[model samples]
Target: MIVNLTTLDQDQAIEQISQLEPQLFGTSAWSPNAIRQELNAPARTYWADIDPTTTPGNPVIRGYAGIWFDGYDTQIMTIGVAPQHQHHGIGQTLLQQIIDQATADHAERILLEVRVDNTPALTLYTKNGFTRIGLRKRYYQPEGIDAYTMALPLNPHTIGFQPTHA
Candidate 1:
């Protein structure tokens, strides 16, 4: 089942991330230092797939998602599902979990930058109610590619926040 990403799972996440490095930041591989840096970043939230306690088949650590807080709003740091695990609703599941947390943290909105070339991920965010707010020129590092700025309004129901009168 899906759950919050853990500090103990850093090693496994790093290893898995290495395998998919080519997908992001272009063909240049990432260093262990980079992986550790990401895992230990301040004000970051991460979620991971775990070994199902009541099910069969190797859990294999499907994927992970993360976000960084910017005081006023939360910025989506990164989100990815293992290639074999794509299209199984894992992306949506991970995103939902993060959205829940962000809203709980009192974030008014969630923002992210995605490569314009990433059609599937863009579609996924769009389908999940994220709207394109603007464009960032050469936003993706190492690739010098533009990214679409996406924002998702956090509904109170999704994060269990109820307002009260003074």
Candidate 2:
């Protein structure tokens, strides 16, 4: 199930995303401090996909995503699914939620940067109507991997795209 993540969920989200970072992002993984700051940052929204069967008051986060909307454009900050949960449509669900949030906020567009070699992420973005806008060389630190900046225009009347409601 997908749920909005608040400061109350910070520690669990951090631990789960931290464990998945090495497998999902290599050296570009976000630090725990970074996650903490983002969770508390203004105009930022985060969501977590938790196992529905998990115990009450204790969730097992299968994946998590975040975005920042500054009253105009919405920028996807991060999206990661555990290796064990990959290919189960959790990423797609998270992306759709972000898109819905952006649209609801009347955002002009949504923007994100994906590592050049992350095929799965690229496919997910493109399939969701995000177009390649530019490239950032050496965007991922330490590993020095290139990144493709992508965007999705959100004017429904112009793009013929509609955000889904679950």
Query: Each model's C-alpha lDDT?
Result: 0.78, 0.89
Model 2: how far residue 7 lies from native, Å: 7.3
C-alpha RMSD of candidate 1: 5.1
Task: Please write out the lDDT profile of model 2 over residues 8-109, one tens digit for every residue.
Answer: 367877877788777877777777887788888999999999989999888898898999998889999999898888999999999999999999999999
Estimated TM-score per prediction? Answer: 0.81, 0.90
Total backbone clashes of model 2? 0
Local error of candidate 1 at 146, Å?
0.9
The TM-score between candidate 1 and the true structure equals 0.81
lDDT of 2 at 88: 99
Count of backbone clashes for each model?
1, 0
Model 1 scores a C-alpha lDDT of: 0.78
Which regions of candidate 2 are displaced past 4 Å?
156-166
